[model samples]
Target: MTINLTLRQLELFTATMREGSFTQAAEKLRISQPALSTAIRKIEVELGLTLFDRTTRSVQPTPDGRHLFAVAEDLLRDFKVSMQGVAERASGLHGRLTLAVLPSVAASILPRALMQLQRKYPGIDVAIRDVMHERAVAMVADGLADFAVTTRIAETAALAYDEIGADRIHLVCRDDHVLAKGKGALPWSALEGHAYVAMAGSTSVRRLADAVLLQADFALQPRFEVEQIASCIALVSAGLGVTALPALTFSMFASDRLTMRPLTGPTISRQIGFLQLKGRQLSAPAVALAGEIRGAYGKR
Candidate 1:
């Protein structure tokens, strides 16, 4: 009969042959002697070979058993080395970590955080993607990203978030614009006549912005509406229109022509948070990266 003996059973045979007794093999395997005997019997039955020449005084390998021992030794050696490699990789703090962040932060906050992360986990390959919050959350859910940094989460089913920081919205305008002259506590009514560059009407941030204006009894004064915050910043810098964005967005500003004033009377803001799939456990490397994210924002 063809043998279906497992690598385990074969190892038991090898161990017993080396020790010359089931008791000695059991000691090496840290199992009882009867368990070792059962394993060897099962292996012999499957292979239809009397691998061990049983005698009252001692046990010895038959001629065919000696040949099988050579192969079994190599098999166990390769198996151990394979497991060692996996253990080394798992324990080593190296590999790729793909992260998703809002487009505004991609232009502003994330670069600084990435620089700090590179210092600690130097070998990690980091892939940063500029994505919308909805897409960012989905990216993690769909296994496209290891983490998502977002200002808000619309739905909680596929995602969970931990507050990393609080980012406040600031009203932005070109330096030459009329409202740019206004200082402390700009009134909500002041937004009525100014041309504004708002995010696309579809976004949650845009909805928050609209809600702020609505509560103030004013409609959005839009000269243009864009899909991305960087575009909104670009348009604002060009003096096309003004927009309100998180304070972190200001960090992206390299131009001297655009400036921000904190919106007052009613504050419009969203909290910055790290997101992951709700019920999934993070891999070792992902967990390590997440610790850095938490530490970075927690210290701030």
Candidate 2:
């Protein structure tokens, strides 16, 4: 038969056994002696066995009770260990932090940051999801991600943001591209009539690029458009067309395939940062990871 033992019964029974009397167990349990007796009685009934050799003078365990007591002792010991394990995991930094990051940031920046985080908080778990900027921001807002790092911060009811760092926008072109071969900074007028490869649409990067070109009195000259940043980087790598990008991104990845030159029209920069749901407190893992991300720039 299956039996369900209440924790109170086990505690009472164990205390009484160790104390050698129900009276002492009641004191330890802070209950009336009758209440402690009732608890032991119920436990005995559930097991369908007499637990004690009892009379007026003293109480002693029967063979079955002794066998069960040993088992209960082991069980209680294991239960305490299990509780400690849980406490250590929750109270100690040993759980997963779900992270969402824009595709570009995930490739180079996130990995570097994570390596540093692991060194400091080895117990923390990091579950990283790489997504488009819009989806990444939405993930944090919707509780799907504990934190998100991105270049584009979308203001919504869901997210609160902090500035982690910023990078200047650069004109990235194939190493063979004329601008790549020689440049201190690039003027927008130099590309007044040149074809460009740009982000597909609606992305903050594409919008920023458009605004920059627009103010320079030149309309965007798009030869191709794509959604993924990696694709945009790949386009330039393959010598398709030039595009403006965060300087650190190309600097970290892409060997000689592409070269980044400072975009010198006006102020060309993008702030990179972390975002989370409004009023959401970061977990230990997320906090540790955020610290590592901040440390990546070192003094920024």
RMSD of each: 6.3, 5.7
Candidate 2's C-alpha runs over 4 A off are 1-80, 152-155, 251-253, 297-300
What root-mean-square deviation over C-alphas does model 1 reach? Answer: 6.3
Q: RMSD in Å for candidate 2, one decimal? A: 5.7
What tens-digit string does per-residue lDDT give for candidate 1 at 179-241?
Answer: 889576576667777788888876767877888888888787688989877688888888787
Q: Which candidate comes out best when scored by TM-score?
A: 2
TM-score of candidate 1 on Cα atoms, chains taken together: 0.67
lDDT of 2 by residue, 121-201 (tens): 677888889876788887887789999888756566767888877778778887888877775887867665566888877
Q: lDDT of all predictions, in order shown? A: 0.77, 0.78
Question: How much is 196 displaced in model 2, in angstroms?
Answer: 1.1
Give the total clashing residue pairs for model 2: 0
Query: In order, how many clashes per candidate?
Result: 0, 0
**TM-score of each predicted structure versus truth:** 0.67, 0.70
Scored by lDDT, model 1 comes in at: 0.77
Off by over 4 Å in 1: 1-88, 298-300
